[model samples]
Target: MKIALIAHDEKKKDMIQFTTAYSPILKSHQLYATGTTGALISKKTGLPVHKVKSGPLGGDQQIGAKVANNEIDIVIFFKDPLTAQPHEPDISALMRLCDVYLIPLATNMATAEVMVKGLEHGDLSWREIVKEQEGNDI
Candidate 1:
């Protein structure tokens, strides 16, 4: 599975800790993330990650494109709701793309934990087939 990770400036530390805790499970899959977050995670977890530009500089859109194309199966976006973002529209678009693509997205630590746990348990194995069959049914 391909997973994309993103974290707002204020939530980067949480993202790092989350990635560290789940690095073993995550090591089996391909990982992609925005610049600073990716660097931080890679440094701490030693997990290889494809890094894109910073979020405000089009990183979110890059990840959004992957999600739209079904190239990413999961997205863990740790957003800081208390702080206003300068690139709010990009963030919103990323979340919207995840919904449109039917990809699992976590916008906070609690939800990210659920998603990561599901990943660890292999609960998402049927996602692709289910999405395909649902499309045919429709």
Candidate 2:
């Protein structure tokens, strides 16, 4: 499975800890993230994360594009609902794309944990079947 990790500035620390805790399970999958979050995860957990620009600079949209194209299976985004984001529209678009593509999205740590565990327990094999069907359409 391909997983995308993203976090708002206020939630970066939590993202780090969460990624560290799940690194063992996560290491087996292809990982992608926004710029600073990716750098921090790589430095702290030694996970190889493909990175796009910072979120405010368009990373959210980049990840959204992958979701729209059916390249990413799961999205974990730690949003700071208390604060205002300059890129709110982009974030909304990303979430909308995930919904449109039927990609699983975790906006908080609890859901993220469930998604990761689901990946570990072979619960996401359905994604492979879905991908195969998508290929047939092409």
Q: lDDT of each prediction vs. the true structure? A: 0.91, 0.95
Stretches of candidate 2 exceeding 4 Å from the true structure: none
lDDT of 1 at 136: 94
Q: Report the CA-based lDDT of candidate 2 relative to the real structure.
A: 0.95
Stretches off by above 4 angstroms in model 1 are 130-138
Taking the tens digit of each residue's C-alpha lDDT, what string does model 1 give over 37-126?
999999999999999999999999999998887788999999998999999999999999988878899988899889878888989998
Clashes of each: 0, 0
Clashes of 2: 0
Show pairs that collide, candidate 2. Answer: none
User: What are the models' TM-scores?
Assistant: 0.92, 0.98
